[model samples]
Target: MSHTPATARHLLRRPDGDTTPRFSYGADYNPEQWPREVWDEDVRLMREAGVTVVSLGIFSWARLQLAEDVWDFGWLDEVMDLLHAGGIAVDLATATASPPPWLTTAHPEILPVTERGETLWPGARQHWRPTSPVFREYALRLVTTLAERYAEHPALAAWHVNNELGCHNLYDYSDDAARAFRLWLRSRYGTIDALNHAWGTAFWSQRYSGFEEILPPRLAASHPNPTQQLDFKRFSSDALKDHLRAERDLLRRITPDVPVTTNFMVMNEMRGMHYADWASEVDFVSNDHYVLPGPRSLDELSFSANLTGNIAGGRPWFLMEHSTSAVNWQPVNRPKRPGELARDSLLHVAHGADAVCFFQWRQSAAGAEKYHSAMVPHAGADSEVFRSVAGLGRVLRELEPAAGSGRAPARAAILFDWESWWAAEQDSHPSSRLNYKQEALDWYSAFLDLGVRADVVPLGTDLDRYDVVVAPVLHMVPQPLAKELTRWTENGGHLLTTYFSGIVDENDHAWLGGYPGPLRDLLGIRIEEFAPLLDGETAELDDGSTGTLWTDRITVTDTGTEVLASYRTGDRAGGPAVTRRAAGRGTATYVSTRLGPEGLCPLLARTLQAAGVPGDLPESVRGRVELTVRAGADAEFWFLVNRTDEPAELPGVTGEVLAGDAPERGEDGEAGPLVLPPRGVTVLRRAAARG
Candidate 1:
């Protein structure tokens, strides 16, 4: 196998230059799966593949701790010493993600309980309840042991707190959870009357006399109260966060110098946790991401990568787990096509990932994840998967120059809110299919198509940073934030919001007065009623582009609002489907329909141009490629990536190709249009004069 130069990875740099390399590469290592003889072979192979770090012992508590008091560390000590001898760093795990089977057998209540009142068995990992005191006692004991043993080990890099917190047990509905829920409500509402009012429990004679009467909203007689559901989601996230904080605090107390992080599963469907509130609690952010195996996989991957970087305050984050090929968890796990491995890894780097790692180093011989692809596939070191992994490792090392570069400045930003997603996805809504995430993705898809970079920002982030702010399906923009957004547009920041926006408050109650409550006056429009279409139905717009899934019948309350495009078909025909109104020195645009990419691209391009946001790309690479810029204090690195299978061309300027599938040179010192191979990625450094 081929390899890059041996080096550690980002993001701390001391004045003494005692820092590791800019990029680190490795995978999840579980030596407990193999015999002691295989451990030496594993390290040898890692060295050959340029592996610098491995996340160790994420689920090894059973092996480490035999009983309540009995403990064993001889094996883990050997593994750490072996990795250090092989010059590999260890991202040590607290081994709290999965508890041992005996613990569950002894204290069955420690396991998470389903909404149906069934305790989740211990066969699967992370079976413990996040809010249970017994689970906390055992998990923290394991973490304390690991921290004390490996705090000063030479191989230590970072502390992985617990594997993907709340992946399966996010909303435990046991009695413990009920008690915690009452406490959480007391803290939030301060009084039973306030809780009753917020939950709107007066409607069905379901009013609670006291905080203790409130349950987990489990197995409701009918559709659960929306506000209760939303709060439950918040409480679930906070519960896990509290556990993580406890584990993190213990890890830090033992090893204050080592950075600590827990991997988050960030995606459109996985919306249980509100990561915005949890971002500041970690030493650094790490994410576990996987493409959903579809046509829009690249776009979704880019969106997630950019979102991860943005959430980390534009700091270079760790790609803790992604696949080299097929992941076993998916129903129809599709293997990555040729050239996709390097392409996918490089895309994360373009979005400011300092390290690229996968779920595992080797495939399991037996277990649930036996079919899951790893850095070293079951086919051994000579396989195509290993070749790709080695190749990506090489390219990551080549990305040293742009390793610490932050996300380039963007003229546009999109609001990705957890509360809004939860509220929109609640049952008994106007439409159960109303996807808050897909709508946000629609706007991001337009940006990607325009070859422009946009920040996927949080709701509370400063609005003054971007010229254009797009909030698609912001179903619950509270009054204070709505006022802030209004001030932003009035101060010359172009604001864009979509259907179902400003309809609800933070409490999940509809904003009184009108359809789009707080934003109506600022947007210069009023939505009378929603006109959501059935699954197979679609409507046309004035520009001949089609909209599906949703549309709103809007009226121009203020004459200043300009109707850019109206619904050309349906009972609500001639209504303002899209409108733009002048707010101070800028525009407040609203698209009251799901216009997919076909209808959204041209509209966004026009809006961006109006906002003076540059979005020019080579015609050949316009739709089939991605352009991401990482601007450092000294330079700006422009990454041009080909997302299609066919060759793509991009008008090239004078710059050095920092890495991978470089542009071909043309005559007279004029670089020709960049003809990138299938799934090719190239980074170009702009001239200092341009900077």
Candidate 2:
């Protein structure tokens, strides 16, 4: 075993590796909510709570611009001065997330009308129409003004463009949006003939002869075609991207040096915007992750972290929003049990998060988010939550500058594509029960259980370095991606794709030849017919265990292909559920049904081991505990976090830091499992070694 040096390089790092400032401890602070007299107290409390940076003006558009032409920065200027005087950096928000009430009131076109044709009333933020020219002009003006004013501010560290975009489900299908959609289609297809072919409109007597005939697919009396729906999804996503690009371009003109970013909500699908497309324009990706109470919260966090890391192209990311204690949303809002927040924070760091910031500094006094958790509760600085924030601040102050100094190294990659996600969801044949995220979670959980360091990459990424690649629900088989996967499998790289993979083109149209489409040769299996399972129905696998959801009948096409698990459902009661094919020096595995963990985990483990990848972590690490590795120049840091309240012991051979001693071993010469108190975390540094 190569003794991994316990070095600082495994930690998160600045872009320059020297001059770029490592993200410091921060929280979203809306001092504009409070009076000027309260500034000193808030600053003092922030200093106590270890907040080195504050994200300001996130939802202050209405306040900043009370009138059409008048702009007010007097209070904002004072807040910036006070924060700078107190040695705290500011992530200056462009304040474009929400338009001022006047803008919406004066120009109804800027207001987003829902699918039901209900125009959003005033006061709600994120209600502006993405494609509205008035919105575009005004939003750009706000961004330009902020950039020009704060471009040289000594306190400014970065620019936050608006709050979370696309938070709401509504997208305008108004006349303005319709015209914009036509323009977007014109740019994409160039001619109506190509658009007709892509949409297959000839089937429904919907072939458009002119660009003016096109309209965004809005809710109609009849059920809309999947192709039209998919196009609308794509159009809305593109419109939002165009909005971001416009603001980003203006910001770049004024402040070319400071990084610009926007906070994105995780697992949000309505807008059809994936991180991959946004990553191209952003300096770095930041996400607001809300952990709902459940067994899968940790897994969700890991998935999000991996997604962000992948979007950054192995670059470090920032945690834009996390709860300090209890969340305000959810029917049952529960507080974080003891050390859960800290443990989650460190896990973010271990998973390539350069900075960790909460949603808020002080608790809200009014509105929908009044009860949301914050570093400072309504009780002020004397509260226990305040003490916890202060304690965390102390730890971060001591550890962050050094610990957040490097990126993690990963060898395995999982491909996540938005086109695939959209295509899978739009498929009329497959069971509506076939969820994309659940399938992804199944594969991601397997990787986590095995302690494999894998990056969740996009479809178009370079895959040469990865030893194994997993593509779940790859419904949209882009030609380039199909070729890349073929090349990868042919080059001795192991590949695995799950049910609902490789079924459609970019237009949500089924591939002409066979199921798995372009990947059929690589998979060596031809899917004949898809079988959808009804609710409360179950089908058994060849392993004699029952499975749920949809199943498919598959036949081996090549001599190298072999059935691993067979489905027992409908007329194809004994059909293969999983199949493997030897392609050149490597192999490909195809799963035809959504299998539960019992049927999925063991199969994944066996496949990974066959591919010479580590399939299991030490048994001493509890099943609920998640372990991730981040490598540095000399050392690798193992972040072991117990996301639950149950006590879990650390694996043997690891030294203890919080307890300040080497771990004691059992009779087996393994270190005694360290009991992690509920929501507790342990970070162990050891020599980087390959199994």
Writing each residue's lDDT as its tens digit, candidate 2 over 128-238 gives: 888889888888888888888877777887778877777763367888888988988889899999989888888768888999998777677675677778878788877
Roughly what TM-score does model 2 have, to 2 decimal places? 0.92
Q: Model 1: which residue pairs collide?
A: none
TM-score per prediction, in order, is: 0.96, 0.92
- In model 1, where do residues sit more than 4 Å from their true spots? 1-17, 665-671, 688-691
Estimate candidate 2's alpha-carbon lDDT, on a 0 to 1 scale.
0.75
lDDT of 1 by residue, 1-691 (tens): 1211112335422223366447889999999999999999999999989898899998899999999999989999999999989988888888888889889999999988888898899897889898999989888888888888887788887889899998888999999999998899899999998988898998788898887678897987799888998999999999999999999888777877677888887764778988888888887788888889777888889888888888888878888999999988887999999988888888888888888889889999999999999998899998999988888878777778787778885779998998898888899988888888888888898898887779888878887889988998988888898889889998998888888899999898888778899999999998878888899898889888998888887889998999999888987788888899999988899988899876899998898888898864765567788888887767788787888899887664446787765665567875566677888888888753352
The local distance difference test score of each candidate is 0.85, 0.75
Top candidate (lDDT): 1
lDDT of 2 at 268: 27
After superposing candidate 2, which stretches have Cα over 4 Å from the reference?
Answer: 1-23, 268-271, 401-406, 568-571, 655-675, 688-691
Per-residue lDDT, model 1, residue 189, is 95
